[model samples]
Target: MATWISIEGHRRLVEIIPNEVQELWDKWEIRGLILVSLVSQLILIVLGNRRRYKPNICTRALVWSTYLLADWVAAVAMGAISSNLGEYYENNHKKFSKYYINPQLLAFWAPFFLMHLGGPDTITAYALEDNELWLRHLVGLLSQTALTLYIIIMSWKGNWLSHLTIAMLIVGIIKYAERTWSLYCGSIQHLRDSFLRTIDTSKKIEQQQESNNDGMNFWEFLANSIQKDFENEERRAGDPRNYLRAIYIFVSLFADMVLSPWDITQDRKELHDRGCFHWSTYFTLVNNELKLMYDVFYTKAFANYGIQGLISRLVTLITTIVVLASYCKLSENKEHQVVDQIITYLLLVGALLAELSSFFFAVFSRWTRHYFRLRGSATFCCILGCIIDCFFTKSRVHISMGQSSFFTIICNKSLIIKGNFFPVNKLEKLSSVSHRLTSEHVLQKVYRSLYDKSERSLQSNLSGVPGYRSLLLEKNKPIFASEVEFHRTIITWHIVTDLCYHFYDEPSYHFDPRKNSKEMSDYMFFLLVKQRQMLPVGAGLITLRDTVIEAKRVFEDINVVTQEDNLGEACRKLLERSTTIPRNEDLRMQSTSILLHACDITNELIADAGEYRLPMWDFVEELWVQIISYAGAQCRVDMHAHQLRRGPEFLSHVWLLQAHLGLLDQFQIIPH
Candidate 1:
């Protein structure tokens, strides 16, 4: 053990040492690159896996930068090494060249660059568009493979190191191929095609089974058949391995098919009515299932499946270990530089550790346990599944306040849009408003300005407010006549919700939904102005800019110059001064007072629900959920497609969820 530590310490020190006294050059470029590649692999493996656990902009950007740099650094290293060869050949040809150093080690290192290009399995594509670059990657695979091969042949003679290089080249090609193929499978078109094939095979088998059993009444036969089919599908959905495949089946079947809300409800009627799970358990299960869907569309998960992928990974791991062992054994006769030797060892060790981590992640994965269970391997299933269950239980127990809200917002955001008070103070403050945002008056004054502008259609055309000619609405028509109309409703109700909350007098009446409601409302507005491409066509940003300008002018007139942090206290003081402003006050000030009065009218409307009365927020929460879900479904698929260049937007996921729920009109099956 002492001797081993001494050798390891020597290897560490050699990494920073110069190769030769006469040559002033440190020969550190290749060493620096190898370290960068190793670091990149570790960063991606750790960060990429955590992405699904938290969906924030900062985390997304971190993963995005690391992912792109992984490939870029490795590719650039290859170009550098290739350039070094020209210099290597020139220096060695000089007859009196005592300073010309042999570059066999550099050439030997080329194959590892190909291995780095393979990337970690934790992430293949940062976004949907990355998968579309599979063809370009394929071209890269061929070009880089040839370049590495050429480097090895021209620079190194057939020695023991040459044999090791060949071994590494084989492993590198396999790794690169796996990544390219994974990218192909992750592509939306490829997934859709795979789904079609699975459906066709299932139908053929079902037809054969039905032909063998006959002589029953049509209704009796149909009912029994449907029951059996549902049971089979339910069992499949219950298993982690099959659940993803099952999702693909439904997604492919319904991508362009249409059905109504009632149809979707009826389809899931049996599961809801007779399933063993409660609503919360069912919600957890669906979330897990959708997470798999997210991976299929956005990551290299689909490529990691099947018997072939398992064998390829196993071979790559074994070959990497073999190469490391071979190099150490052969190093006894070689005069290799200390830094170069350390880099080779680091590359090999990094590969071994990365592969091991991936294996552990897979073994304890829900998919692995389900696979074992389906195959009747009770002992393995119980052990691995127990470990996974315990891990998740501990994770849930450690949930912090912020993580709780973050996850809740992600799962529920796609479900609804409600009229909640989204305070501007919580986020960016108006440059014009000197007061902190805790007061109703701050928002009320702004809403009042919007209300007046809305009445005269100044903001209507700005946000593309729907102009319906008829007074009566048709059955099954959208509740909001236009996208702009829905936008106005959102603004109006936001102010109302805030005022009602502030004026309610009872300190004990606070609810979680009401608190969370403001978050959702603010986030939606954030998406509206900032992520407008994800929503329907509108001039929301322009209108919002106009509102900000007018609100700033109002702030200057009121002479209420308070810092943003003090706005809450300012609002409390304002409310205490008078419930009704003086009649001689500016119309804008009166608008603030009138909007507060409107909140009273809203409170009265909800106070009269019959026995078993619902809280005002309960209705508000449900209403917004439906409204947001509707708006999500209303966005164009083209818009969703365009934004795939960035990471998957929450709005796109909601759009897909609406399609799964049969809420979209695009579900009608097209004839061939």
Candidate 2:
């Protein structure tokens, strides 16, 4: 240790008597630090292999990993002096460049980072799976862009590396822009959904309020509220509206589950009554929704730019131009080229980190607004991690699957195998046995239902009111009541379909899992395999079915599509203040249960038909059964209901998305 100097009367310790004598503490000594860094890298790999640490601790492991890797590599050219004294001796003859700065390596790896960002439609995020997590992806991409630009600058003299990096950047920007556009389109769909829901609710409430003033009983009032429609000015007392309503519900979901096979293509025809929106309506919807999404998407950029676009753009442009000029000028200085490289690299790194920080502020602002819950916020964080490669060490990233890497053509042409939801989905042969086991069930229920005669009488009286029709005996009614009966049914097949292996995982969810099966069992597996979510069409068709049911219970006839009236008997078992109940009471967990269950039923049907793993589209047959059941029932009850009401149109669109995504078991083709 060096002695301290004292200026007062106290005895002073001697400093280095001469500048040349201090040379011992220079370049050669740096070797030890470099060696320590190398040792640390090996230690980390060992510990990671031994399963001694967690991947997402957000500290310790991740920090030390990056520091060790970056610094160790940096020690190369830096540690190259002939001796520690040479570092400071001003050796004019030495060119201090390292051969390790290979342009080919940088050229190969930079773009691989970007390819990892595509984000599946089934699950657009990792780190956080929430739909709102896209904001994080945007930020991560931008940061990576800045970092890549810095590396590109350093390697610009290497023409091939420079050109490759530029090409990757262009492709990356285009891909990112496309994903943003897709998400924007989805947001538009969501807005349309909200609008339709509002309109339906408003009209229903208005009619009910009028009924209450007329002194109708509570049952009557509820029924009227459930069924009334405002769009039709020519609804009649005994029209065939109920039949149309049922068929619409059956047809929409059936079509979505079958021929369409994806949620993105849900058609307007599937909505209860909202046909293809007029061109003007479509444009207005797109513009408004896009405007709203953009506000949400670019919120961070806006904040950084003082919440004004013109100012932000001008400032960014001016700043970038100034930076480029400075960089170019600095590059021409031969004496300070090394210094220039380090400064440029530092600036680039700093800017990227700043960009990331800024991205969160914008995303967090929205996360705060929409989720307002811990899980939601956490989801955003997780998604951010998934979209950005920053969380994982370089060794862990799946270079092949990344956004910036060479595009690959993976052919994982297989899907997850599944089975049926319940006994009802068993094959005709097995169903025979299933039915025998339950033969006494129907008779027992019929007589049991009669025991509640008083309730039925009350319901009948309510349904028979002047303007409304009876729920059960409507002019057009259920060809069979089973369509409505499966309302509360549970389906667990969707989860099974997600088991197909992911091919392009760069950083496997588990870094060390040789000894822990539990760790293997439940994990955030970063896979290219598709996860699951609800389709707009499934939700829409279900909505249409529910709307029709609500209509029958509230209004007596389909002719009253636009009439504001009451069916005293038909009422929901329960009502939420806003937002109707879903097909299943999935308060949490996830939404693709129906699709999953459908897959199960198909599997079961296929199993019974022949071999277990065969491509028996028998599941499609069962789907048709359901479609026909609902369609026939709706056609039968046409004269029974009082009103013809419209349902959410977005479900049709979701159905289309499902079809497009290629998990098409629910949708099947039936030839004439």
Candidate 3:
């Protein structure tokens, strides 16, 4: 009897609580949702741009959450307002007047929701995939516009406030339309189609010119022109604006559109002649081009260009200001509820502030600078350029590479919990606790390696590895690094790199090739383990898992602790274990464990370095670059485009650089 009574009372309490909550929601739902929507917009405006360079999980999550919720919240608020309008009409239009807030104030709030649907100027799509959903947004635009119009029509008072509502509605629709158009243009199919059209037109012009010209082709003529331009030393000093223009021409390549031989030749000559072949200038050009591409793919920067964008901005600004002023004049009567007036004032002030901020971003944007320069608006471009130099001098690209260590993952104990019997290595690729800045020395070395390979025409080979065999032979190693499977090669090299990194004493060189090699090894391993989708299909995870399981057993026998000082000793002991048995390729391949293979490679590298009297770390560094570039070139084109939405990947930069250098297979030279 006591249990039954208690259960019945508990059920009654559950039933009573929802009734009270429902009653409260019905009263304050519209006001609460509106305020929340406003807060979301403010958050997006402040935090959206940070995702480009600062790709920490916290920032991405907050920005992504706000971006998604900003739309949903505004749509829901509009629905609530529509429902309220329906109720007011159902009650013979007398109920809202009896309520504390006027129905017209509720109707005024609907336009604010429409503006929120437009989103902030900083971000449009969170990922590349979001751009593909333009039709859904178009559908949303029509439905939401209809719903908002219905709300305004039902609650029309034909006063100054009504006129203000109509004006704000116009601004809201314009903003939403711009976002939809941006998505449409940014879509891959549309982008590719536009590029094809441009290419077709250029092809026709080139054919006409070829018939009129001497025996020299269009590319040869362009190359000569570029050589002449290079005579002016001032032009060779890299300009950021040049990269902005290059993006317009080369962005189609990222969309998987083919470039003609003449196009590649012209681009290569321009880049080489302009001193962009140097490491620093090359990376700067690539980084700036990528940032511009990011703006095109994911921001309103593309839509807010040219005369139409300017007119839209002007009209939206004027209309919003006019409406705000009209509302201020109308508010003088003070006959409405205090809460209603306050909400209306907040929406107006928020809209005005958002517009001003958007305008500020637009005027100082790289796109705007490029536009004014093209249009010969020198004064505007010069002034804006000066302001940017003075205030925004920080490098926009984050040049740091993420590092994940296989040894660290194997030794980490926290990854293994009691309930989970899974391998600790498979729990999660250990979070990158550290990052290495892409030093200029490494960049120069990589640039030289790729340039040398391109000159030798080695990049045209579609079989085996690109630069692996030649680099290995230079060290007197008869074995091909590609003898093993690609994934196994990565695992073996990574482990070998780690062992060598710990076993050798720190070199006194100013630019330590050991450190560079270690960073590339860890970064490639990080991609294999964490970002596998960006790489070619392989059993990298399985290879890594099997290798980690074997290493875990070795660590258990050695009773190792994962401290800095003890890591070297642990590596020394592991090396001793592997070297104890004679190296055998059959044994290495038969076993899933790559630790032995890594040991064999390490011994070979040490032996070859001693025999050749060469810096092993130097060869190691170049070999890793070859591996990375191979992966970068072979990676799917769309994957590189997809990664741009996240922080810029070094691999993508390399891929773009290779394409620009005419090193990729995509740039086939068709004979005239």
lDDT of 3 by residue, 426-486 (tens): 5364544566677776777787777666656623553444566556666564554434566
Please give, for residues 1-672, the per-residue lDDT of candidate 1 as tens digits: 011123565655323433363233324555677788789888888877666554456777878888888888888888877776777676565631443335677777787788778877777777667878899999999999999988887777889888888888998888788789878876767655654454444445456454643333212232233334455644532444334333432345323323333324434443334345433333234345445555555554544543345567678778888888888887853585555567778888888887776656655566555544444468987797678878853321111111011112212223222332233332222211111122232122222322333235311332122222121032132432222345545544454444344444334235644554444455455556445566666544443433333333333445544343344443344344334434355554423323333333344533543432335555544444444555666676645554543433445444554443333445432223
Q: Any runs in candidate 2 off by more than 4 Å, and if so which?
A: 1-307, 330-332, 337-479, 483-672
Task: Return the lDDT, model 1, position 235.
Answer: 54
Ranking by TM-score: 3, 1, 2
How high is the lDDT of residue 291 in model 3? 81
Residue-by-residue lDDT tens digits, candidate 2, 535-646: 1112322322232233232222323221112211111111111123244555224322233232233334334546332222223212222222222222211111100111
In Å, residue 233's CA in model 2 sits off its true spot by 23
TM-scores of all candidate predictions against the true structure: 0.70, 0.24, 0.89
Please report the candidate that would top TM-score against the real structure: 3
Task: Output the lDDT of residue 168, model 1.
Answer: 85
Error of 2 at 129 (Å): 8.3
> What C-alpha lDDT values do all the predictions have?
0.53, 0.29, 0.74
In model 3, state the lDDT of residue 365.
Answer: 77
Candidate 3's C-alpha lDDT?
0.74
